[model samples]
Target: MASPKRPIRIAGCSGAATDRRDAMRALAANCPNDPIDVIIGDWMSEANMTSRAASKTDNVGEAYEPTFLEALEPALPHIAKHGIKIAVNAGASDTELLHSVVTKMVASKGLKLKVAWISGDEVLPAVREAQKANASTFENIRTGEVLNSWKFEPIYAQAYLGGLGIASAFLRGADIVVCGRVSDASPVIGAAYWWHNWQRSNLDELANAFVAGHLIECSNYVCGGNFTGFKALETKGWENIGYPIAEISSSGGVVITKNKNSGGEVSVQTCSSQLLYEIQGPWYFNSDVTAILDELWFEQLSTDRVALRGVKSDLPPPTTKIGITAKGGYQAEMHWFLCGLDIDAKARMMETQIRLLLRPHAHRFTKLAFTKNGSAPDDPTNQNAATVDFRVFAQAPKEEDLMPQRFLRPCIDPIMQGYPGATPHLDWRQALPKPVYEYYVTLLPQADVQHKVHLASGETFAIPPPPQTKTYPAQQPCQAVTRGPADGGKWGRTVTGPLGWIVHARSGDKGSNCNVGFWVRHREEWDWLRTLLSVEKVQELLADEYAGKKIDRFELPNLHAVHFLLHDHLDRGVSCSSTYDFLGKNVAEFLRARHVQLPVRFLDRGRL
Candidate 1:
């Protein structure tokens, strides 16, 4: 009764929070011809989860992301017409609310779709009990502070669930699945598992599908979006780019492509760049399986078509990570511009002035930070080019101290008497302080948690638990390789330029830590890169914030890439950070722009 000849095709519609609603509509419209079987969307992030958890206190159904409904409203007709199954982790912290809203919408549209809600990921009660028993064991991964030892009690906690629960829902004939806090790649893994009836121990097939899942997890990212080599796709259709789709066969062979008439190109370079996002080391862990990153390889089958292979899998770790959020008080920021010459002197003077002015009320705040962003380049062409954004950020214990009158008046009043060429930016919102929710990421034993699938028919199915309990040792460096001296005889003259002239990189945040993965286009340059970009070298590239900081480096030889994780660089993650690039998304670009010496051979391989 099944079509054994055809491979299963799944489309990734949206990557993160509120990703281009029009793009989702476009993917839905084009899916009929491509015959996409399953559609998945990812809408939850660390910032979103914290916001959603806080929203539940005000209203019942307000916790779920609104964009889920907005994206599906236009696609419902096409979905129903094509018999497409939908799965998404757009539920945020509230799956029941999302399910109710989506069910009502589907019913009102007269569409006969079975919507299933997958839950059991929430572990607040267990966390509280554990906190009471021995609090120190639930140490925050970022700061190594115990949960019970925190400044404020945690209000919400959710463990990251895996694909098995989602796959079980599909096996129960559910047309739509709304989930809370599943792994980012779970939807794709779930759809493929259900399509082929994969066994839990089918590690080979599952590993192949897992690689496919990760490739398209971020949707358009694999389709030349956010690619380091954007210039390569410049002439190609890039505007209004198509989302990524995986054509996975029954045997676990994967070929990544996009919709026929859509924009974007899916080349080896684009696929490899997406692979480096947010990864720390070679051993990539998931709730379902452990993917060996170094073993994976990519092949260009055709233009806009890449086949991912060589990925090997082992049994998953015995535990899954949990994210807990607590009130972190309030924070406010004020920005001033530093123009013309003497920029460093002006910035230092501004910091001294603000600190001295707030000295009388120093006890009112927990943290105060002064940041100088951008600099006056040599021989500037315009006033904007010579201006640097100087910011003063403060985090306070109470709302009164963080108020506009208290926080802003001190900084704004001294601006006129402050350093030469200094004036506050005319942004009113900078004066007002906003509440901060601190996040704690810790691991929970998989055995202590339960996972299940809930159906519209009021039936629930349970997934089998982990087979063994094993504590994975804290991640240590293993993959970085030692390289002998580069033979200077074959190399020609050295050229000086930005490091990105010969390297491509992608960076992202993982809790308080940030990772930047750097790669070279040519294989001949790997030896030189490995020797030049050591942990010490990377720390130097990051400048003072990373000076004397713990920086770990790993190598993915298969991709000709080197990955570095900067510990505690994000300043307690996104919600409570004073940095403008809170999530560390710009870290790679910042490093790429740093000047470095490169041999002519490697430089010639790229478009220098």
Candidate 2:
């Protein structure tokens, strides 16, 4: 270990469900010679957990993500040799099975690696009992739908666990710590807590740890990957992107960096982009701490290093978010593209023909939707611009009702006779009906959910509950502004152009809500942005998706960004959403493509 005065260097190898990318080998190949104290891998995702739950029911032994072992296969020997500690949340639903498999792998390799796993995120039994008893605590957060009213019974429910259990495992000297359903940032927080011996009430220090965890949680996300300003950064060797490493000191200050010889570049823009990824508003809440992002600022120390400061922390909320997955019936879609002129008319004709054909069988489906994916040709530059994808989606109670080929027979068989310039872009494999998982997100009191750490010695201990009990409102939005930017700027005239001319954007999903954050580099542009892009203006920009939805807008003056969260816009979150852009990644780009009138001074700079 480095001197006590030196910061603890922790490297994050894998982001959520990135096992297929061979993240372990990257870590093994890139472990700095200076020695990394801890390594973290984020493997669990909402989809992964739901799938793991189903897998466990099929076979008791196969509960965790098997790719996790595949990821660690190449790096285990190197890690053992270096005595480097590992804390990962790769145990999606079955941490015990993960521990068993890992210990066996360690023994087979003839290495002395102690392993521990943590549990207690599973709450299916308690939730089912409460639902059967007609408890009022299981109501859906958005729709006000009670648990008993659900069409299909939930297969599994897991509450987001905190980092205390992971911290406990590390404190007890476990070489490898595996956990199930912990929050994405928990492994980082747990490792930091153990390293610094932080107390529960150390909100300021814990807040810094939380910031570091959130920054590096997605691995390469803070290292220029998926960044909106990627083109502006040094792009050599981008194919071999470097992962994030946080050097967190005892005082909670962090310097985020990656391997010097590695690919991706780390800068203030990259860090800020990741910081705004999935956050709802200025206050980012976690199970461990609630960080206020209103005053957060990032400073670039060097090319591959950045520092974050001014973020304040408060006690965590009384409850933790819980995700419940239920069978949402079978869904199928038939895709056909309309080419050349009269795209709308062709799409309308297709919808009419398909609706008339399926009208007789309408009662069999819970939902039947016709969507025109693209619009008419604007001058026709490319084949894609002149073509529009007309799709018909159907969901039914019985799988047979959505038997893909059979259900889409009417649409496909009559395509030749229906409209001119119509063709399909998919093959037989894509025409099959797929199972949908209806995701319900709500909160459960942290006190009711128990967290336990199973030690390598076969003994377990219960983790303590959060110290504070605070309640956040169901919906919180910043005050709306009714003013415009100062008109005089070098006394130049205004010009109308795409919002992307002076704005950069990043968007992501939090449950069913979609957040899009827009930023401008110049202070002059920011002044115009804050007043130009109000909640109503944003609603206008994303008019189609924002229809009949509540939108909350917040301003980040330091980053020159405006963020808006569209409530219930993603249907029922990513898994069950019928929208083509399920994860809301395109929402920001879509908004940036919208035309807007802006000051000529900013546009003249050619910084678009």
Candidate 3:
């Protein structure tokens, strides 16, 4: 009989472009007991790509993430000494430029490391050609709006790539691999594929790694960074929160853990929080494979170690997600504080005054909103505590329309005549107009992308599309019962309090859509949760934010969770959104804070 092969350990350091810069060095140098075989990081996102496209259009900044270089510089010596391979998608738009810069850095250090870069994710030319042939080919995935109906001119387009290219570079004797806009989990998937030498037909194994990738892709997320139970980590302190590490066996079993002696934790609850983040539904799709998330489960194996099991797979879809960035317009804002009693009347009076002042130039503005941030407490202790902000936001197609004289003058014209205690913010620069970039997400044929890898050995080759593909419905059938909650008599007693008293949640954005997943810690609470939190219940709780928005709800019985996807809730997406919660990170917390009738049986255990 053959013996079981040893598992490969992969460490994740960065979650986004602006993540902690010293994480790479800390992971490389601080992990003594858990030596990693490879290091993978994700640096690209829809909002980031939009900003990069705008920068490139104006000829102002580099087209790639500069922080990647800063992160790699301090860890290069450790990486070379331990011979740990590295893969990252930090080369946002200009992979060739980043590749050349990294090569020079490696040589300048007198290091003989081989660096390779993968490109062809950028498809601006292909998108233009396709639009000329048939605009419907690039129709919006969310709204079904054809490309021809788009008001803004697209400046750049990039398709999400799979991990085969990264694996090919590793096979070609590359020590480091850099990529542009590959799917966030591609780096982890590629490392596992190269380490196991698995074939494309290994769908189950690939799916396991895919889920593992999703869990750790956000770095410290699975280690309690965004967890609702974060107060539990007070003993260790959050200053040095640990990054996640995935240990995958040859057969595709995965154990998620973090660096020893680091802050934060690796428990079933923490891992479950990351699993439910930013996901659309039960079927989690990537270019390489689709993971069926309904049946997946997590178990605590030991302290700071959780095992993932029961992951199933299906063939990937023939289409991949593509993001196009365009100049939306220009935006400006101003804030005024309303203090003490009658806050509602004060806000209404200010709104009426601002509208009348700008009534003549309303045609020039595309969007105008008067937003009230918070409500004052009935009996506040101090002046600061009694004040609430009333903000004015304006958007226009022309820069001059949003300038200080044109936009700010009308807003400030009603100061003396404004309600009493109305205090405008002292900062004049807050009213200056800034360029807005809109991010449009759509589907692109996989064959349209020329996915390729340039090896360090002076050889280059193309990566063909997946051998097998399957088509999935726009929405999967709900697997859990959605009937109303059972009679209150069975629960013995009930209490009214914050929903967070017995539930935990994680929420994020998918383009303009906001998805929030709520779960319970105990199995007994799952039944009450699934029945109590239905689509109508969610709408009732979030009436102000998503009352009229189209919402899709799904259940994950294995995780004791329910998810809600609110369509077009972000206004246009992060780069162009005018809402304070632009990225939708607070949607979960917002729902959690809403008062609800909670069963005392579940509350007896304790709050999250």
Residues 95-152, candidate 3: write the lDDT tens digits. Answer: 8888999989988898888999998888889898887888446778777687878898
Candidate 2, residue 17: how far the Cα is off, in Å: 1.8
- Given candidate 3, what's the lDDT at residue 313? 94
- In terms of lDDT, model 2 sits at 0.80
Which scores better on TM-score, 1 or 2?
A: 1
lDDT, candidate 1, 526-591, per-residue tens:
777877788778877888767465777788777878888888889888878778888888999999
Stretches off by above 4 angstroms in model 1 are 1-5, 57-61, 468-470, 479-485
lDDT tens digits by residue: candidate 2, 293-402: 87887888987889988889888998888888877788888789888888778878888887777766777988888888878666888887788778888888778887
Best by TM-score: 3
Ranking 2 against 3 by lDDT, winner: 3
lDDT of 1: 0.82
Q: What Cα-based lDDT does every candidate model obtain? A: 0.82, 0.80, 0.87
RMSD of each: 1.9, 2.3, 2.0
Deviation from truth (RMSD, Å), model 1: 1.9
